[model samples]
Target: MTHATGYAALSAESPMAPFTFERRALRADDVRLDIRYCGVCHFDLHQARDDWHNSVCPCVPGHEIIGTVTEVGPDVTRFQIGDLAAIGCMVDSCMACPECVRGPEQYCVKRSTPTYNGKDRMDGSPTYGGYSDHIVAREQFVLKLPEGLDPERAAPLLCAGITTWSPLRHWKVGPGSRVAVAGLGGLGHMGVKLAVGLGAEVTVVTTSPAKSADALALGAH
Candidate 1:
């Protein structure tokens, strides 16, 4: 086991505190990453305060992560020793589940394992998140970083980008589709960009009139 440095809460109502924990030993199917950057998602704030009452501490809060692959399991093939790999809001899925087999893991029928503040499938240990120095996860949940994507800015894409991508893709928002994104923060911004890029007429619907210019600058009309 290797020790990791992270920010976590000791209980549901607590603010995050500096903490340390051990990374599980690498499994033959696992890839180890030296986490360099992690994005702060609203979910992290919610879970840290136990907004859902499911908070189990010490809750390490993060999922959007960017890092270098320092080690790979003997059985891993898609990644090598120095790949720029990423982990999103997911860590594992029940392989036997239908969605897992189909690659839409966000819909894993057995409930896809979350990246952090989740329970490990095998050890039952609480899965701490990426506000840390290292993480180990199944290769299925690891995404390869495309070139020129900044590690810091790119972290959020692992979650925000795909969440928006799915809906546009599912609805087939091609030419002539009218897409209106309700919010411009995080997920919503990604939604607008993806929809517009896919040839839809993207309208960023925002109550914050101040951000209107920013949205339009991002290619929304």
Candidate 2:
């Protein structure tokens, strides 16, 4: 186990504060990252408050994470020291399950282990999120942060960006496709940008007339 420091919600009702805990030592396929930027999601608030009722305290809530690789296990092949890496909402899953084999492990048949508020399948250890100074995760769950994409701005790509992009990619959205996004918020805005990038004609139907200009600026009609 490795000692780590971070902020966590000691109780459902209390605000997050400094916390120290042990993270499992690197497995053959694991990479340890020194966290740099953590993006907050509304989901973080809900989990921090135990709104879904399954939160394990001391809860550290952050999934949209960007960091620099600090260490890699002997079998780690995808990343090396100093490379920018990102961790998303999932940390691990039963790779043998049908859902994982077919892709989209997020919908793993045996329940995908979320980045935080999840239990490690192997030892039942509570899995913590990225609201910390460092995190150790299997290399498969860590994404390579492309060079020149500002780490801070790119953090949300792990969640918001992927949330929108996955569906579009799955549906084979491309030139001549018609896409309509219902809101102009985080996920919606990213949907508009990606849809348009795929050469789709995008229409953003929003309740807020105020967001119309913002939508157009994001490349939606």
Q: Which pairs in model 1 have colliding backbones?
A: none
lDDT of 1 by residue, 4-100 (tens): 9989988877778899999999899999999989988898888988899887889998888999999999999999988999999989988888878
Q: Please give, for residues 90-138, the per-residue lDDT of candidate 2 as tens digits.
A: 9888988888988788989899989999998888999988889899888
Question: What would you estimate as the lDDT of candidate 1?
Answer: 0.89
lDDT of 2: 0.92
Instruction: Give the whole-model CA lDDT for all candidates, comma-separated.
Output: 0.89, 0.92
TM-score of each: 0.95, 0.94
Per-candidate clashes, comma-separated: 0, 0
